[model samples]
Each structure stands twice: as structure tokens, then as C-alpha cells.
Target: MGALDIFCYTLWILGSVTAFPFGDTLNRQAVLKTNIQTTAQFPNNTWLENIAVRANGQLLVTTIVPDAAVYQVDPTQSHEPLLVAKFPSALACFGIVELGLDEFIVTTNNWTLSTAASPPGSNSAWKIDMTTFSESSGQGAVITKVADISTATYLNGMTVLDKTAGTVLMGDATLGVIFYLDTYSGEYEVVLDDVLMKITVPGPVKLGINGVRLLGDELYFTNNNQGLFVKVPIEKDGTAKGPYEIVARFDTILDDFAFDTTGNSYVTTDPDNTVDFVTQKGSVTTVLGNKNSTLVAGATSAAFGRTFEDEGILYIPTNGGLAGPVNGTFIEGGKVMAFDTSVVA
Candidate 1:
């Protein structure tokens, strides 16, 4: 909350996380891995909003409504899901990001963004420490509320940044702004905001900036309702260095995205029921989904695999089938899906 230099924490690049070389090598094939009806966990009104991949090949999925459960899916195992932790049926779960080896930060909604006894719909972020998490021991991730973020309008997507101190950058889907969170002090600061982030086409889903990621000094985010993807370079202190750059515009609802070693972006188109393979050149290509009932619709988030069994693979989770069908109506439970890049490689 003070000067950026006072809180600036060193940004760590774990493994090859931010080391990719952007290009054609990322425009690979996308194959459907699984849908909710076919999955072993979450077969109800669980809206799997976001996902984070464990280096061991397991995935942590955060749900949206009905049931606030975090299920762990292991492809290397029998593919059966393990219960990591379930939140109160009242609280809301949205997007998640890996903080460290077994630590993570999760974005939430429903509560007022104030510290007083207000109402729901106000958003916030949380920290899940899994250093000692173990299901066999009847123990799991230790969850804690990140202080001071009660003022967030609609905390949606998140990206970790040590901008002077331990922090995570969060995007408010409704406010069209990104806030820098001080993980240690519990304070936050709005680091970026622009007209491009405001929901110009307020529709049934008027979300502004849905997903965000930082590569070097560049910040990438989705203007959901506007169907636009944008990026901008920021100074070391988290100030914008230049104007917003248009990455691409799509015909469908662009929800969230993930980056691969080639710097190619894999984006999910919500109601369109598809994922787009976006190259660094700002070209859009369909890699998964078909707007059908089977593949995966309502895709709210994406992340690349971190384990050997899943490395280079793009992992995705859906908002069940609650987002409405393009041609008809149906009930789809929250589920996890993935794309195997080996065939394209």
C-alpha cells in the first residue's frame, strides 16, 4: 500500500514457467479429454470455475456454486478424483493460481467488498497453504483469508507478482481493474485500469477482465463482454509503460487463457463451448470445443500442466452447463478437461 519499492518482492520464475519462446510451435492440435458427466468427481451443480496444476500431475479445481469443493484430478493415477477441501456451501469460489510448490491463491465472490456487515457479491481473494496437506491424514490445504482485499469489487482472475513484496495481482471482472495484493501485509493497490477494461457491452455476463497473466513487463487480460484480448507493458513498480495493446478479438465470449512454452495462448470461449489457440501474432485458431453438448462449455479458466505426466498439456475446467446452450438448454455438471499436445508436436 505504500511506495512500490517498499513492498517490492523478488519475482521468482519457477522452472520454465516464464521461459517460453513465442510461435507456430504452440498452434498444436487440441483433443477433448473429459466432460463432467464422464468424470468421477463433481457430477452436480458444481460450477468448476478455475484450475491449478500440481507439479505431480494432479489438478486442483475450484467450484463456483451449489457445492464449493476443490477436487483433485490425477491423470497419472486411475483418474479418480480426490477431495482436497470443500468450502462452506455459502461461500463462493472462482479462479485460482499456484503460489509456490504446495501453496496457492484463490479468488472468491458473493461477499461485499467491504469490511462491514454488508451483503454478498463483493469479491475477495484467499490463500491455501498445502505444505502439510494430506487426505490420508484427514488433513488438507490450510485456507486463510487474505487481509485488506474486502474492498475488491469482483475478484475474478489472479496472477502472482512480487511487485516490491509478496503479492498477487487480481482482476475485477466488473470494475475492469487489476489490484496488486500484498500477501504479507494484507493490503492491496490498484495497479492498472483503462477504458478497454470496462464492460462496454453489458450483457447477461458483463465481465470485463476475466483472466490475467504477466510475462516480463507485459500484462495480458480478457475483456470478456467486449470479446477482446489485450496486453500492456508495465513498469517495475507496476505502472503501465505504454497504451493497451490489442492481442486479438473473437466472435465468442473469451473467458480465460493459458500460455505455453512457445508463448502461444490457449483461450476458452464460454457459451461457444470451445477453446481458441491464439498465436503471439494475434491470430485465433480453434483447438477444442464445438458448441455441442458433449465437449466442454462454460469454460471459465485454463492453466498449463506442471508435472511430467501433464507438462505442456493445457488443462481446463468448466462452469458445468449453467451458462446456457447455443442451440438448446441442458444441465451440465462442473467438470475438468485437458488437451494433449503430443499429437501436435
Candidate 2:
């Protein structure tokens, strides 16, 4: 009401914008780029846990809801996810891997800390058909019951390896172990174990392996709590070598990563987290974060499209503040965010 009060208000506004421009400012030095755009969101029944893109440009995503369905989303459509297949009595579906044309694999996390009832065998691997997205026909796109790794609590991340060997690699968040499985014979082997325990850090003990991506002969994964992107050398036999090496380290929590064709790696962090791009020479750049007006809330996972138009665009899935208290009040759930990395860096 008074002239002095008005002057003070104006100065406060200026200070706020100058100090923190974004609505949810977490990292001060990181610049939030404008090219990032939202793609889709699942509110009530759709709790998307993991995503995998097929060679035909179709996106396959798994959910944690009661029905435990796998969805196929048209890349051209906006937030429209068509339910392909639903597993009965399955609670949480975590990871997905494309096997071939109209075929894929999914890993389920039966035991969730947030839920009361747990599915039989903490985690089970299943094979599904992409065309019909069903396991019933036993002829068409069927869901073949695969191995159950009950010993591993949460089988979180998955990626397809050399198809000639019919092997797929998966990350277990509950036990911090990585397993390599033969798709044809159902044979499985542990490639890496206790990865977080092996890493020496001074902070509070946090051990969970989330995202995994295979680049050439090296396998790169994320240690969520430590905010570390680690690489392990894989032998010709498809096994990992000695201790895994830390490729890039960050202060914030990391979710998933996308590799560009040029061998550059782009990783997604928390809603208030910063983006870290690592070059082949081991250089790191913070292309997006708190410095700009664009705010990333509850960013969970990211994937790089193979096509030229979408190749460099990073597809990010957000919870949009719906997944409970962990995401916070400002951040909402069920929204997909796309960031054009080719132009940003």
C-alpha cells in the first residue's frame, strides 16, 4: 500500500528472478534448455516403470498398476498409450527389452516397499509378443512364462545384447546384481554382483542399480544413490570383467540414460536434477538444469530414438506429482518430456 512497501516488493521480485529463474530451481549452475517438451502422462491406472523402443518406431512401456499391462504407444501420438498385454496377478512391471520384430521381454518386481501384497517370487522374467500383446493364444503374440529370480528382489533394468547369442542383460535394484540370460535356452548367469557395495564412498550407504545401456563392448549402468554412471568391460563370451569402473559421477540422483549416435551419453536425473552429457574423451557438460525457465519435475527415465528426426531427442518420463510423497508437491506425475540434445549442446 505504501511507496516504500511497493519499492521493496519490486526489489524482492527482481532478486527472486535473478537468483532463481525456474519455478523449481535445484541446480544453480545448470541451464534448463527450452527444447525439452512433454509427450505423455498416465494418471490413475498407468504407473509406467520402464520403457523400450522397437525397430518399427513403436514404444513399449511397462506399468506397476494392478493389471500389470504392457503398452504400445505410437511415436506420432501424444500421450496415447494402447494396452497391448496385461499380466494377471502381476503387480509391478519394471524393465522391457526388444527381442526381434513383434517380440520382447519384461521383468516384474513383485515386491515393492510401498505395497502390501507381493507377487510370488520377488521377481520373474516373461517373454511377450509385440503384435497382439497377449500370452493366451500360445500361437500369435503370446506371453511365455520365463525364469523367476525370486532371490533378486527387484529386477529393474534390461537391455538386449548380441542377438546371435540370444542373451539379455538385466539390473536388479533390490540386490545390486546384473544377470545375463539366454533367450533361447533359458540359461542365465550373473555377470556383475554387489556393484554398489564394491564402490567405496563416504556418504550414507545407498546401493541400488537402476538403468543399463550397452555401448559397443562396454556396459554402462546407474547407481541411483551415489549418482554414478559405471561401465564394465564385457568379454567376447558376454561376461563382465573385474570391478566395474565409474565413468561419470554426479551429485544428484540418476534415473536413466540415452546414447547418441556420436557416442555421447545423455542421462536424466530427478525433477530438480541436472543433465550430464559425457563425451567419448570423458568430458562432462551440464547442458540443462536450474539456470533457465524450464523446470523438470520428477524425471524418471529417458530413451534415444533411432530415427534421424527423433535420434537426438531425449524422451523423459515424469510422475507429475502423482506417484506419492517421493515426487514432492510441486512435481506432477504421468507426463513425458522430450529434450532435443542435438541442438542443446
Candidate 3:
């Protein structure tokens, strides 16, 4: 079959699956009532790819299109995005995580969504230190290039595996592998390579293993093309402590997710424009948004608020239906949404 035919066939198969995990009777079509508020909005074509929250509750948002830039958004105040810093020679910025006190690490690449391949030696990591930046003083932040990931393609989600050891795990969706980077030494190596990380079907969207996170002794991730949320016990050294387990599976594309204190995972469905709440026991519920809803539309990545005032808030950044338009026609400017998860029913 041709590529378009295969893509259409994949969608049909995905849409046909309706059984819930472990055969629970809960309706998959149920959408929970959520309290959502738009915190910030950018230009119509802006693609907000990833998000990270500073200790003081400001948001660090990244974009991949138009420019590989990072902006600092204060959710509590005017919500105007302050230009933090832009990366040089990078078309997009992907995963970002806090490395240390007010310091962060971000992944940069020259890859475009229209093309399947990125230029060799264009994948790299950089550090953003927000230590001296005071909003009152109008001081700027510092940006430094950490290391180049010449060996991989399409580095997506990231999480700090060991902070003191300066080791961060990054998922390469194109390569179907995970790389462990040592921030202190600027060295990186492939630490995990499994067949489950690869895309199951050959089509236009070939993304696999989109999101990666570490909670306690287990590492959780999402396989976008396969539509699976998986987890595996891991050591601090980035090695698996046991076999990987499939937490849940769905009929839609999966993106980045955030965990709550009670071990519930709020996973984003990029094309479906919804957030699935996956409990520790593996049951899934569509807790926020839907395929036709503009609320958290094109939600790409999410992070819970850091400060106590907004700790129960799930902050999501969207590409504004750039990936897949809601109801196949609705598209808007990229935005940041604050969902009050504590008030969700």
C-alpha cells in the first residue's frame, strides 16, 4: 500500500479499538468537568512544544517553529511572555527540565515537522541559568551550550535521572532509543534501546517514544505511534531494574505528561486534544478536553505548578492545533493553559 493508504488504515485501526484496559465498564467517551483558564497566548502559528516551571512559579515555555526560543511567563501576574533567550542555529527546542537551583537544560534541533530527518550534528543540549534574573531589576538570564548530540535524531522528552550525578535521560523519537547525558562532563551515550520504542506503523507521523519521566524507582514513557503508556523500574544509573510494563494503551497519539503526588499521571493526547488521567493501577480516564474542545487544544506538554499556591494546577502548552486541528478545522494561536486539577470532577 502507498504511504497515504497506510496512514489511513492506521487511523481506522486506531479508531476501532474501544475496549478499556483490564475490561472495566467505565465509558471511554466520558469527559470530566475541569476548571481551565488560559494563562497566555502567542501568535497563531506559534508552536509551544515544551514547558518547565521555575521555583518561584514562573513558567519557562519553548517553541519549535518560527524560532527556537524560550520565554519566561509569569502565571500570577500579567501573563505577558518575557523573552528569555533564543538558541542559535536551532529550528526548534524540545524537552526541558530543571537541572539545579533555578538552572535548566533544554534540547535543541534543526529538525522541521515537514521533514522526517534532521541535519547531522544539529541535535544538542544547552543550559539556562535563572539565578540572577530578578523581575524587579529587569535582569536577563544566562544561556550556555552544554553538548552536541551528533549521534541521535529527534530528541523529544527529557527528565533528570540523577541530579547530583548530572545525568539526564532523553528520548529520541526517531531513533527509538534513550540517551543518557552527563551534564558535568558533556558526555552522552545510548542507555536504552528496545523494539517497543519504535513506531508500529510506517506513515507520515513516525514519532515513537515521545515522553520520558522518572518517578521514584521507575521510568515512565509514552510511545506515540504505538499509542502506549509504559513504565519500568530503573536505577539511578539509567539502567532498567526490571522489564518494562505497559501501563495503558489508547487509540490516539500520546505526548508529554506530568505526575501528581498520588502517583496519577496526567498524559496529553496531542492530536485528540485531551488529557488522560492514568492511575497507578493502569486505569485511564479522559479528565480534560476532547477531540472537539478548544480547551487545552493541541496540548503538547504539561507540568504541574511548583509553588504551593498552584501545586495542584497542571500547566499545559499547546501548538494551537498545528499538529492536528480540532474537529479537523479549528486552529488558534499557541497558548498556555492552567487547569485546576483539584477542582476536576
Off by over 4 Å in 3: 1-27, 32-34, 136-139
In the order shown, what is each candidate's alpha-carbon RMSD? 7.1, 13.2, 10.0
In terms of lDDT, model 3 sits at: 0.82
Better of 2 and 3 by TM-score: 3
Cα TM-score per model: 0.83, 0.78, 0.90
lDDT of 1: 0.68
How accurate locally, in lDDT, is each candidate? 0.68, 0.62, 0.82
Tens digits of per-residue lDDT for model 1, 1-345: 123311221222321223222222223344554422233346766677788876455688887666555777765546467767766623667677777767778876663212211133456667788777764553667888776366677777787675346677888877788888877777788989898788888466567888888766778888787878788877765679987877777767788887766566778878778778787777676767677745776777777665544565667788755676546776677677766755442
Q: How accurate is candidate 2 locally (lDDT)?
A: 0.62
Give the lowest summed-lDDT range of ten residues in model 1: 5-14
Best by lDDT: 3
Query: Local error of candidate 1 at 262, Å?
Result: 1.0
Residues 1-345 of candidate 2 have per-residue lDDT tens digits of 345543532332122101111112122245456787656656643455667776555667777654577776666664366667777756677788777655788887564435523443667788887675432332345788777775665677788786666678888664677888887877777777764523345564344687887766677788776667777767756577645666666666676776765556677665444466765544556776531223445455667664545655677655443333342434334555667876655
Q: Higher lDDT: candidate 1 or 3? A: 3
The top-ranked prediction according to TM-score is: 3
Cα lDDT of model 3 by residue, 1-345, tens digit? 345543432332122222223422223555766588889999988889999988678999999876899988888856468888798779999899987878999999997867745666789999998998767644668889899999988898999888788889999998899999999899999988887799878766688999998876677899988888887777777888778777777778899998876667789989889888877667678888888988878899988876657777889999999888888899998999999888654
